[model samples]
Target: MNSIVTLNDTNCPITTSLAIAEGVGNPHASVIKVIRQNIADFEEFGNIGFEIQNSISGAGRPTEYAILNEQQSALLLTYFRNNDTVKAFKKALIKAFFEMRDELNKRQAPAENLSRMDILQLAMQSEEERLRLEQEKLKLEHQIEEEAPRVAFAKQVEAAPDAISVAQAAKVIGTGQRRLFAFLRQIGWISRRNEPYQTKIESGYLDVKLGSWDHPDHGLKQSVTALVTGKGLSKLQKLWSERDQDHAA
Candidate 1:
């Protein structure tokens, strides 16, 4: 798992409203509502940045979410009723923000000692690195454009009945079904029999459903079909993306 907080483009440590919702086990809209209701109080710490992200659902609608700095995020927590889950998330979030800020501080520590020529050299190096990043960004944007059709299809084929079969998940993830099953098995998320491990089930990443089919002459046969929940699907997507990055590297 990654840190719950992240550094934003402005080099500020921030956490999103969505992450807060997921961590606190509250609906995203409810979290957004709280932010909106208490906007003035939060702004007292700093100006909150509101942005829109496209929905991954079939509707393809955009939703508004807020980005909050450490103080604002900590303050927002006071509006929620205290609970074990909320308290735990708050602790984790605060730790993450502290760690990120410490990292930023460490990165800036060498600036005071730089000579004029060292600063000039660093500026040139930074420009070269920025150009390289721009090229990579363009490539990434092109890749996203190419995958738009598949992503659209995935949204249309939403996971149903609270979960989806491995085959269905493969379609949503834009991978071959057999390949996905193999990957899952190799990662120990599933068994050789293609069933999710008991631990994964407990983690709410997967589930099992009893299924039956008519046998040729022996009558009916029963089987357990391993299923992937929405959470599991997102996890798999992230893992697959990391795997691709590793392969590319």
Candidate 2:
């Protein structure tokens, strides 16, 4: 018996019912009757069955032939219980299906210039890169959480004095002078000014103490610097902690 099965236009391996009958050494009419009897079973199995195709009969008259795909052929084999030939035919049909599927895959793969093995290697590499990127993203998120200033600053804020200097506040908050100033501006506590600390003091966000100091090059000069109030410190701490929590979430 010829084991070669031709693929349809869609590159699916198919064999006619007449071919299946010939393979199983059964009459065409008998095979067709059995298929019709258990059609409901085939329909339940995702409608894997046959389609009628025009064929010339032995008497030179045009008749219908049932064209079955791999799935349909396998399904039909279940009816021929204890039949060794049917079992062998099923195996051959399965092998042909796999061959046709692989051929279709090669034909449909992108980059026709590349060999199948090369394409598979590229696919594996692409998957590896995707996984690597995902892992890196998770690691970066963990690092950001671990290094957040809110964790340490929350503790510092609880132990802070009633009032602290801008420098002291910066140190407690784990930030640089420039970054602290920027944060103050962002929070609307201070605007563009020659004396931002003094402005903050006037805005009631800080307490100011006036004093005089002697400079190396200059005579006694009036110096002014503001201290962050207890309330202001609490507010800033809450803001940072909430922001950190939001990012973590």
Candidate 3:
């Protein structure tokens, strides 16, 4: 191959004017003279990189030459009149440049594959983070919704309004009467019959009073009823929040 082509430091394929002269069977000084004269035209493709080379005759000053890429090479070839030798060398040079490019692409294939894989991995991670942040945002919105009612209830109870019936307290607490009754029993605040325990009543969390009602068959009758005081409302709210957190955990 007569070392037809090689790569520059930047990995670009280049041939020197000296190599062009050798390939075309021209005098090296003659080729240099042509390049120096037509340099402005050749520079239209790109800057022509000049370098001093070892003197061919191993005497006198070193020979000066211009480094050229494929396009610059084509332009330089136009300056020389067509000949069989020059034509043959042009074809060989074209083949040599193409072979160098193929070699470079083959060598870089693994690195290119790695770069594409890295990009894909980064994209996947970004998507995962986006999804995670979206889920957290939704969870926060749900929590705010749940807290809104509880906040309103807290403000109302702290104002210490008159004692209200257990049923009314259930409505303010955002639960059904039966559900509150069951929960009160579970925490031993009341009995299975849903009446406030005497200890709780004395502690000022509840009140017990006679509720009289008329029956169809019987005369007026009286039974004990439970009511929630303001303090009890506040405590129930706290307990309800704790229960929800436990369930979530």
Model 1 Cα RMSD, 1 decimal: 16.2
TM-score of 1: 0.46
> lDDT of candidate 3?
0.73
Error of 1 at 106 (Å): 1.0
Q: Give the CA lDDT, 0 to 100, for residue 76 in model 2.
A: 83
RMSD each, Å? 16.2, 30.6, 37.0
Please report how far candidate 3 places residue 58 from its true position, in Å. Answer: 4.5
Candidate order, lDDT descending? 1, 3, 2
TM per candidate comes to 0.46, 0.39, 0.43
Candidate 2: tens digits of C-alpha lDDT, residues 1-249: 235576554446777778878878898878887777777776664454333232435333223346677767778877886488877877777787787778667756678788888989878976776677679657755643433321222112122247777677777777666777677767756544413333344344555445589989998976544457777777777776776688899
For 159-246, candidate 3 gives per-residue lDDT tens digits of 2246788899889989899988888888877766666665566567776655579989998975666678898888888898898799
lDDT of 3 at 119: 67
Reference-based lDDT, each prediction: 0.76, 0.62, 0.73
CA deviation > 4 Å runs, candidate 2: 1-4, 46-61, 115-249
By lDDT, who's the top model here? 1
**After superposition, candidate 3 runs with Cα above 4 Å error:** 56-58, 112-249
